[model samples]
Target: MVTVAPTYHVPVLLRQSVDGLNIQPNGTYVDVTFGGGGHSREILSRLGENGQLYSFDQDGDAERNMPPGDGRFTFVRSNFRYLTNWMRYYGVTAIDGLMADLGVSSHHFDDEARGFSFRFEAPLDMRMNSRAGMTAADVVNRYDEERLARIFYLYGEMKNSRRLAAAIVKGRADRPLTTVAHLTELVQPLIGRDRQKKDLAKVFQALRIEVNHEMDALEEMLQAAVRALRPGGRLVVLTYHSLEDRMVKNFMRSGNAEGKTQQDFFGNRLVPLKPVNNKVIIPDEEEQTANPRSRSAKLRIAQKLG
Candidate 1:
């Protein structure tokens, strides 16, 4: 038996997310992003013997954190982007509730070799699934300046995207940038003293997003969640960044890709999902004090409507 790390992961918004599911004792459920199985274990506690839980985690390391199986739980080692297809493969048509906690796992950040944290000088790798495509170095070194600027602007929402891109281009001209430290040094001067670290974080975030195709994966997962849910099933998502939160907010409100509000001839709304709460939920002071990473988290819940 793999000894679970004493400090594997502290799932953010634990109460909020599990409560958001409104779990039914005998009903089937899915935790699309099962980091450390924190929410999954909580959901299992409330489930009856017949109840079933399907959990998905793309990171292979998460498998080590899995609780001892009891035939009631199933863990799928794949991205949540294929939620619908995977559910079908398991002979499940519709789930009573679905929970997705989308953020970098604490394990990933703590493992320096994974290279997620800016605090460490490690390889530029940021692939959630190590088996997959290009690393962050490939993105920084190979992408054109305009493309880099666009990623930084759209994903990171960086204000000095042009300057940052230019700096990267210039820095890489002499030799290919191959590590997180290399990129950090190149962009820090362009960002200057005020908010320099934060700016560099944004740039790194953009690179990681582009390298992993996070936005596109999120879109695919959202669409799959909507289609796989029953009419009254709930879709609860916890997002840490504005880009993801915006997409979730719009999709829940409009039930369309464009996020445009729809109305019938009688001026009735055509939204297929209704927000359980009008406002997003943030971590309480207590939670934030315990886990700083929980500070930026935003939890949003919606119930699928006919």
Candidate 2:
């Protein structure tokens, strides 16, 4: 068992997700979200001398988790959206497996300075790549009310999205929504006490999604993964939210983002990848109780067709 930093919690269903790869010792693989290098390390353990692993993460913090001078490993310090580009740059024509553990990483939420959680009075700067892109404060303070509403509704799945957006717009008119405390104080009034914490988490989730362009980036990475994977290659992904899970499920089923499968004249379903599991895998109660954040995880696996 590999150990991680105190702040970076171990991923749930770690062995199961890695086992889904059906790893080939000499085959090349990629771990697109190497949050704490847990999955990357596991992949390395299963590989032979010639096996290669390219782990991608935008956060500089993740780089700290890289294995100790492994020749087989390469850390790509960029968003997984450029999966194909990075592969091409490395002169790699195809990959045997690609695994992605999607959603805001646990470490991000645990790090108060990152502004992923509302538990602390931190600045709303939820950039995975802290060096780039818009901050959550930027989204809340500058985005139009309608756009804000859509982000909350789509990303956060909040029903009171419109009202929440309106409140932010109105509140920011008086004082900019700059910190977790600032946003929480302004919106806490609108939510009922029973669902306040849950809704507030959603509110932060929406802001984080918009600030990071997560959905768009995920779609791009999936499309690239499809093209990069070789025949019989495994695409094991652990998605945290319904929207991303749906997107992964659809792409694997139909070979497109629309989930529309194409068939030949023989009526054979023409798809690039086949779902390895008919049912999505989730953490059992025992595991969930141990790590509450793993409760929402949905693990989906697919294999590229010949």
Candidate 3:
């Protein structure tokens, strides 16, 4: 709840994301990832006095950026995976729209102590919700070679996953890998200087995904999103990585993680969500230049049909 002078996070594709909600002045909405209050503040401005906004964020730093003294806004300090439970507790059964900007916030990368970036030497702790769950160090120092290889291959999409995992196991046996520097040194030789940063990012992405169980939470939250929204309510999600973008695309198209469309007796598709756009939206050149981190962002919008 401590407020810092520096910016907490920068919202990506700000205008496009908020506009995709198709806001109604008096309608209710939810910002599932309220990192900097940028999106929440924008929604508040467009809202009537009676309009409600519930912003959810598990990170402690996000609470520090809460919009001050806004009675129309309610901040929920919980992960969006429990969207249904929190909505019921607040006496809200349905919402007009929901927006989620997935992936790591800018604050994590800026704060070297968080260990989200390889640019700094810090403790290998990359938990979005730092108060709970396993850290990056735990995975690196503990997971078996096979499990490590699977995570690297599946999540990082690393081609040398087995070799990388074997290296980690061998390195850790001699001495525990506790900090970002230690892990980087162990793997840097395998990744060559030409592709150092890119390769390292992929490995870190794999560890972060495993530590946070991001894919599982995303699937659960998406299912809850379908049930939480009123008919015709919009769901706008901005994903930074390919895995996340792919999953979002499938869910929006099929209303299920497997991306299989169910058929009714009439042979009509029984999908809860209907895609609003035929193609995924990407940030324009201006945005990419201004915010280099937003280069990978892909936006997908959907509406609950039933």
Off by over 4 Å in 2: 1-7
1-306 in candidate 2: lDDT tens per residue? 434444576777888999999999999999999988888888998999999999999999988888887899999999999999999999999999999999877788889888999888899898999998889989998899899999999999999999999999999999898898989988999899999889998898888888888899999999999899999999999988888888999998998877999899999999899999989999999999998889999999999999
lDDT-best of 1 and 2:
2
Worst 10 residues of 2 by lDDT: 1-10
Error of 3 at 253 (Å): 0.4
What's the count of clashing pairs in each model shown? Answer: 0, 0, 0
Model 1: how far residue 154 lies from native, Å: 0.7
Cα miss at 114, model 3 (Å)?
Answer: 0.9
1-306 in candidate 1: lDDT tens per residue?
A: 223335668888887888998888899999988878888888888889899999998888888777785689899999888887899899998888999888787788788888787889999999888988899988888889999889999999988898888999999999899887888888877776888777777877787788778888888988888888888899999998889888889998998656999799999988879999888899999999999889999999999997
Prediction 2 global C-alpha lDDT? 0.91
What's the lDDT for all of these models? 0.86, 0.91, 0.91
Model 1's alpha-carbon lDDT is 0.86
Model 3: residues >4 Å from true position, as ranges?
A: 1-6
Residue pair clashes in candidate 3: none
